[model samples]
Target: MTTREIVQKLWNLCNVLRDDGITYHQYVTELTYILFLKMMKERKQEAAIPEKYCWDRLRALHGEEMYRHYRELLTHLGTEAEDELIRQIYHNASTNIGEPKNLEKIIRSIDDLDWYSAREEGLGNLYEGLLEKNASEKKSGAGQYFTPRPLINVMVKLIDPQPGERCNDPAAGTFGFMIAADQYLREKTDDYFEVPKLKPFQINQAFTGCELVQETHRLALMNARLHGIEGKIYLGDTLSSLGTQMGGMDVILTNPPFGTKRGGERPTRNDLTFVTTNKQLNFLQHIYRALKKDGKARAAVVLPDNVLFQEGDGRRVREDLMDKCNLHTILRLPTGIFYAQGVKTNVLFFNRGTNDTGNTEEVWFYDLRTNMPSFGKRNALTEEHFGDFIRAYTAEDRTQVKDPRWSRFTREEIRAKGDTLDLGLIADESLSAYENLPDPIESAEEAIGKLERAAGLLSEVVEELKAAEGGNRK
Candidate 1:
């Protein structure tokens, strides 16, 4: 079977699981557990798995017995396995299936597939497709972790991660960035993992990441191992003081969670000069700080409009970013491409800056969002969608492009505009239709997100009012 066929066959089991009250997110996680076991059994990596709880042992059982054994196997792997990959895959893992029949059916379905052909056809694509399915289903807010693969491909392509150089995603979501970088290395270099002699760093320490959420972290680890990349992914908060270690990375790519930190709590990390409740800004601070300051480090990050325009700490963080790293390219992304509608986002691509003169002299702005078709399931984002923008991404003079969607702004010019990177030269024709409106669901989600943010701010106001009242009472 082809990758798509394998994805379809595997994904169809999600329906049977749904009847058992298993969510789309839960179904995917469960599939990862089973799929890994099947693959391990196929590869016959005996050292990786204990003999008693092997795939064959679980497959031989029936009814509740099989379900019981499978549960035990997952538990055993979670706590007892010697292989780090196996251990990570099953860490905190539990079966979501409530029925033995459903469990049996899923096992049979997976067993029936042509693994030999599917392996050759590409299991990485198959698993990623499953992840995309779970993301598009809008389960457990999986969309937040799921950066569109097309966008990922473009970012990875732009960075062009090299062998032996460290690549990382602190907010690793599904570990898509690391996986894409790995694939890029293999294809572009025609280099296998065990190629023309491997150094220790090149083999074991090539790519790494840190994820706050355990479920997504587990998925990312499984994703990495399935692709034959032994990437180090830690399970911890990336924004916390004790979060993943910073600095020394050659390339960093990430899309941190959008929204403010609850209760206006900033990270305990004293390393960040300008602290704020804004999660993206905090991640932005960490990304540049994590980069090597010797001038070779580069990064591409996805951040919301608030980072570009908001004042106070937002401005401070942006300034820090500009001074420390080259805020060279900002790609205005189209709306509806994300699950959260109306959240205008942009990708900031820049390399680390070393001198007092500043690294970004003139920042290039590409307005891909303006007048572009709303990106959604009906009109999925693809490489072709980014064709024009990719071509516009040039080392040549900005005037040479002649594309109206492209423009450039000097650092001084940006500073004159109150240092707000929300600079756009062309007014989008779509702006006029603001009153005509967006889809009802999209509009509702946008309204909810705004209301939530406003409520958070209002709480701060309430506290301030109470503090004033107490002062007057005193």
Candidate 2:
């Protein structure tokens, strides 16, 4: 079958697997395992996987025996696989298929599809299609890790990643940013067929990432490998020592996880002078530090509204970001574009300064969120939503331009406002005097989300004050 048809068939089987009470996340995790094994077998790398528990063996079984083997196979690989790729993919893996028929059905379905090289775009795209499907389901909580492709494409176009340049994503969930960058260069250079072919090393080492969750990490590894990228994507908490481990990236495109840090623990790194349990704050510190000081390194990151306007640590991080980098642009993303609904997000595009501070002169803001459509599956967000933004982005000398949706803020103005990067023109009509109003339920949910964030930040402040008071007593 064609790659699309194969992907469709495999995805259609998710309905059957759902009957086994498997969650979408669990279904994708299990499918990743089987898919990896099958690809290896197709490439004649059977020795990499043990003989008894190989895909061939799984394919030739049925009923209780097959189900037992599937479960045992996951354990064996996790415990005994010599290859780290094989081990990591199966680490903590378990078969969520409660029914043997479901297991057999998925295995047979995958087996029937044509297994192409991991480098082939067809197979890689098919896998990505499945990932996107899983993300859209939303119930599995897989959506947060998956940024909309339209956004990713726009960011990649603006950043304009090139071959032979190092790209990384610190909080890479399924490595969507890197995947898009890889594809961009491929299409730009016609897979290196139009231009002189990229050196083999550039083809392999050009992109790297770090994913915290094991299942997502495995999927990212497979995704990159399938796209012909053979680079390391570490599986661990990125805010710890891992944050300090790498630096000097050419371009970084990532949507860091959205949430307050858990358990009120400080990051494990000594590199960041300012520390807090706010995960996004630490990530912001790390991302700028990861850039080179020569002004060549640039990044585009997706962050929440609190990161822009929260007090204390938020102010400190924003100040540091402005001082150390040119915080050039902010694209205020619309609500509901993400599978995680009601999230108000913005993309910060900046580059490292040649020195320690004062690189930023003016910052442009594009308001795409306010008075916009509430995006959902039926009214899915598309590239056209970014047309004006992209045009404004590509315009020469935006400092001279004046538009409602597009505006510029001088660093002086921003510093006067306590270093908050949130700038915009459109008023929230939904919250104003207007005849037509939004769904009361939607407004309530947005309010609740804001309250929860404020609560989290307040708790952090309380803890900090408590620690300071205790230190004084000591």
Candidate 3:
């Protein structure tokens, strides 16, 4: 079977989990626990797992005994495994499969897949496909952890990470950005065979990231391993003392989790100059600060709209970012692309300056969000969607790029706007004029559709409020 087919078959087995009250996100995590054992066995690397709790041993037992032993296996590996990576994967792990038969069905289905084809296509690709599938399901809520692959690819291409340079993602989210950078360098270096001396550095030290969620960290580790990356993936909060130590990186790329910190608490990292509960603002500060001050160290970050226009600390963060780095490009991303469909986002591209004074001369803004098709499951965001922006970004003389979607502003002009980076968006004629209107009936139907969507959003807000009120009572 092809990798795509195998991913589909594996994802379909989640139906078996439904009766056990396992969510799609939980199902993927559970699959990772089982798949790791099988994959290790397939690759003849079972020494990391204990012989008694290995894949063959678990597969041989029937129903109840299998389930019982599986539970023990998780505990044993988590607490007693000789391999640190293995222990990390199993630490605090437990089965969500309440029924033994369902567990057996999942195991059987996984074992029946074509291992040869999976290996040929690369196990990492297969696993990534599964992650993508999970992210596409809006109800799964895995989208927050998963940046769109096309967006990741575009950012990686623009950043153009090189071998022997240290790269990081503080909010890794399955380590997609780092993995893409690894692949990009591997392709350019013939999987590092052409540059044999740098292979060790590229594999072991070139890519690093930190993930806050334990389960997500496990998946990140698994993803890194399947791709032959031995780089460090830390399991801790980056906003704490841990992030304070992560500095002097050559390149940084990330899409930090949106919204304010829980309980309105500021980041505990004392090194950051700005104090705010806005997670993205703090992450933005961390990213630029983490880069090397060699003028060559660069970063690309995904942030929400509020970061662009929020007052007080937001303005200070923007000013600080511009001062320390050449805040060159901002790509305002289209809506409905992320799992949180209502949140509009943007990509800020800049490089750390050797001297942290008056480094930014001008800023280029790419208006990709305006006049764009609504991107979602049916209308997907692809590499082609980035064609114009990419050309403009890489152009020798960006001024010659005559597209209306592409524009630039001087540092003085940005200052005039009170340091708000939320600039650029050509006048959208569709919203401004009714000269090209459809029939009245069509217009009425469109207005009704928008109202329905608004009502649905309000309903979600009400449910959230109710849940919060109940929690207060408790």
Candidate 4:
């Protein structure tokens, strides 16, 4: 079977799991545990996994015995396994399957898949497909961690990470951005054959990230390993002291979790200048500060609309970002693309300056959100949607690019607007007619008609009340 077909077949098995009360998110996690073992066996790299707990041994068993053994296997690998990665993947793992027959059915179904074809298509691609499928299911609630793949690809392409440079995602969901960067470098360097000496650093140290959620962290580890990446994927909060230590990165790309810190708590990182409960604002502070101080260090970040216009710390953070970095490009993303339906977002592209002061001269804005189709399940966002913006971004002279959606503003102009980065130059054609006021006579007539309808309903209610009162008096 092709990788897509295999992913579909595996996802379909979730229906069987639903009877056992397994959620879509939980099912993906469960599948990861089983698939890791099978994948290692297919790759002929099962030295880390104990022979008894391996895929073939587990598949040979039957009934309750098999179910019990599987539970034991999970516990042993989690705590006692010699391989650290194996332990991380299986840590605190347990079966949610209540019936032994259900367990047997799942095992049988996985074992029956065409492994040869899957290997040919790449096991990493298969696993990623499953992740994408889960994220697309709104009921799964996995979309929060998963950024749209096309968006991720576009960001990676624009950043264009080179070999031997460190790239990180502090708010990594499934390590998608890091993985895409790796793939991009590989394609550019012919799998790093052109730079044999740098291959070790590229594979073992170039990519790293931190994830807050435990299950999500586990998925990140699995995803990284499947793609042959050995970079560190830490399990901890980036807003705490952990993030304080993550500096000197050459390139950073991330979509940090939205909303304020939990329970109105502030970040524990003492190094940040402006303190706030807003997670994105704090993340913004962390990202630019985390970059290498050299003029070449750069980053691209996804942030919400509130960060653009909110006063107090939000404005302070924007000013701070501009002062320390070039703050060159802002792409206002379209609505309905993320899992949260109406939450609008933008991408900030900038490079860390050697000197902290006056790095920003001008800011270019791309109004992609205005006059764009509502992007959702039926109308998905693609790389083609980013074509015009990308050409303008990479053009030798951005000023000469004659696109209506592209515009620029000087730093002086932004300062006049109270340092708010929320600038959109495009006038949406859909709302242009509404910008003009309606005829006074027509507006008054419409208001009167609505008032008359309300008065008629009130009269009927008053008559009914009077009749009821008269009946009681009689």
Candidate 5:
């Protein structure tokens, strides 16, 4: 099925529970559980289920009998799963939006889907649309699971993942990077290309991920499986697993969660070098330790600008990163790019290389913030906005790059500045002056200039509005 068709079908069913105060996210989650159960039932009839579950016997009953047994099965399944995440899935599904009429509508809508066809075409698109709608809700805070698809595609293209290379996203929300990488490799290699030949190890062959949210993790698994890619995807905190070595990786693409420090139960890890509440720094340190020297490991980290210049342990971590690895590129992201409102973020790309005791050669910086044409809560971050970054990334050429969108800085230039501040782009004199503009000289001169400009702009706006009003009246 096409993306629109799938969206329309699911949306029609969404109305039944809209009155239950079920958010778009909750509706999608409930639907996901029911869909999984239905598919498992079908899979069992075709082949033996890998484990004993209600789905294995869900097909036995029909009509009211089927509904009764299904509800009972869900309750039983909720108790059987040991993982809190799994338990939550069944528990949430069994209670919320499971009113008889709503439950019947959900089951019937899910039943309408031909599992075989959905397995082939609709699954990935369906989940993607669900993610988009959920992010737009702006309440569930599930938007963190979604990175801009265009941004993800550009990063995957720049990294240019090869078949059989072990790719990972430690903060794999909805598995966007994994999906993009798999699609990239599939397109580049021919149909006859043997995946096994690309790598001898089959079981550990493809992509892997770690997601903290259980629902997101479940969606990530479904996302990967829909694409026919297979491997272990754990539902756990990536920061906890950071210092513990996983050998190394070829490419790591992630957009870790962003926000001010909030209290939560912290996970224990023995390998962490720095103990601070700053999660971004902790994740960066983790990625540093996880990369293999000379393995051509490159990562695109999404973080707020505070990590670039924050003092104390945050600044210390940056110093350590600069000394240990090659800090390559920084893409200054804009305000509305994320579902999380007013968030200022950037993408830091670096290759994990040998500890050669030399400063980073040239750090490429792309100022995409201003160049972007359209941005807002709903209509934000399209692929077009990222086109320049993709081209300048030079993924296909790999070496001998040229014509970058923004300028590159040297180690000396960075060192001259305090804390290697990744200040936003500077091009025009007016804008650059504002960024580097000194504070008012303990006088009102600078303040007067600011007020004058504000007055001038307001006057211009008033005149324009008057003219438009005059025309409308005529």
Candidate 6:
């Protein structure tokens, strides 16, 4: 069967294993272990069992015996690996699929996957789905790994990642941006064939990423391997030691972890050079330090709206970003794009440079969220939505541009706004008057307007429901 067919079939069988206590993530993680073992076994093309463990032991058993041995084998394997996360995953896998029947079913399901065909896009899709499933589980807050694929594609396109240009994602979650950047370069250039053929001009190192969470690290490793990329991911925090660890990158694409630091606990003692509770700010600073002199990196960072408007260190970071880097674009995202509820996000596209000389010659703000369709996990934002932004950005030629998400912002404009990085258009008089009409005090008067609009919407829904019900009755 095709890899898609196999993954879909296995995913469907997951329902049988799940009950009151079980979740989709547990089933998928368990399947990952089984799938890894099966692939390794297939690749070696030998029944020559390593002293560690072999699939034959579990494959030979049947029914209750098969189930019991499978669980025991996983436990033994985890202990042998001596890794705590591996042990937890295996133990959790056992708890998730407690029944022997379910265990046998899972084994057989993965056994159906075609490992040879799996290496191409097939494996990537399966893992992407798995990552999405894990994110939805929200147990480990894995949703952070998902950085809106559409946004990443736009970032990759604007940066125009080539083979020779080194790509890095510190605080890389699931390595989505790095992987996408790789794919973009491969598709655009002639060098890469069935497999990625690195051009001499194309960055030989290809990609590098840093991930802190153990499971995420494993998935990132697996993702790189599945894509035929080798030895570029590091299992550590990128913020604290990125300069030493990563050296310098041509392009750094990342969405650092969001949240303020507490007083008692900081990420590292010597790692953080600046003092502020905001971890994201520190990451931005680190990226500034990590970039080579005029190395030119386009980083698309997802930050809270506060980062654009907050005072103090937050203000300092924005000012520094504007001063030192080419603060080219800001795409304001709407609420509910994230699995984490009620998050309003914005993507800051900038590059590191030598001096704080020029005014932000042009800042393109793509208002995708406003007046755009309401989106959720079930029907999320896709690549098509970002087409305008990418086209507009590229038209600028990275050096000179007249028009495009493009608007020139003077230094005085920012200073007047208290050094805000909020790059929405400065409303002309008519627009400002229209916008001001929506003020909270005017909201009471606007309530009548809102009621009229809601009534119109409700009337439409009622008519649609009535038609459906009438059709059903007929």
What overall lDDT, based on C-alpha atoms, would model 3 receive against the true structure? 0.90
Tens-place lDDT per residue, model 3, 32-62, is 9999999999878898787998899999988
Better of 1 and 4 by TM-score: 4
- Residue pairs in clash, model 1: 247-290
Clashes of each: 1, 1, 0, 0, 0, 7
Ranking by lDDT: 4, 3, 2, 1, 5, 6
Q: What is the C-alpha RMSD of each candidate to the true structure, in Å?
A: 5.7, 6.6, 4.5, 10.4, 12.4, 11.8
Q: Candidate 5: misplaced stretches above 4 Å?
A: 39-64, 75-93, 113-122, 191-194, 199-204, 241-247, 264-267, 377-380, 395-405, 427-474
TM-score of 1: 0.90
The residue-by-residue lDDT of candidate 1 on 60-146, one tens digit each, is 889999998999888989998998788887988888899999999999888888888777866767788889887886444588889
TM agreement with the true structure for every prediction: 0.90, 0.86, 0.91, 0.90, 0.78, 0.76
RMSD after Cα superposition, model 2: 6.6
Across 1-474, the per-residue lDDT of candidate 6 in tens digits comes to 565565667667777775535655556666667765675566563232343356766676789988676666666755655544334334333445767777777677667667666655456666676676566544434577778777788777777775567788888878888888877867776437533445533433678888877666767766665554554677777655444678567788888888876663555625544657778887887776566657365566777787888788888777777767777778777555675555678888787776655625556676555544456654567888776656666663633644333455566776786887677633334334444222343334335645765897999999999999999999
> In candidate 5, what are the lDDT values of residues 1-474, reduced to their tens digit?
666566667766878997787866667777677666665465443232224354535544456766676666667656766644345446444546645656776776667765666556646666677666666555455777888787888878777777766788888888888888877876776531656466433224568878888777767766665555566677687767543644478778888776534684344666766767777877787777677777377777888988888888787777777766788778887666676444678988887767735536667777786634335553556777777666666656524455434667777777677656575375543444345322233124435545765897999999999999999999
For all candidates in order, the CA lDDT equals 0.83, 0.83, 0.90, 0.91, 0.67, 0.66
Question: How big is the RMSD of model 3?
Answer: 4.5
Off by over 4 Å in 1: 192-195, 430-474
Tell me which residue pairs clash in candidate 2. Answer: 118-226
Among all windows of 10 consecutive residues in model 4, the one with the lowest summed lDDT is 434-443
Model 6 TM-score is 0.76
Model 1 lDDT at residue 91: 89
Of the two candidates 2 and 4, the one with more favorable TM-score, higher being better, is 4
Question: Considering lDDT, which of the candidate structures 2 and 3 is the better prediction for this target?
Answer: 3
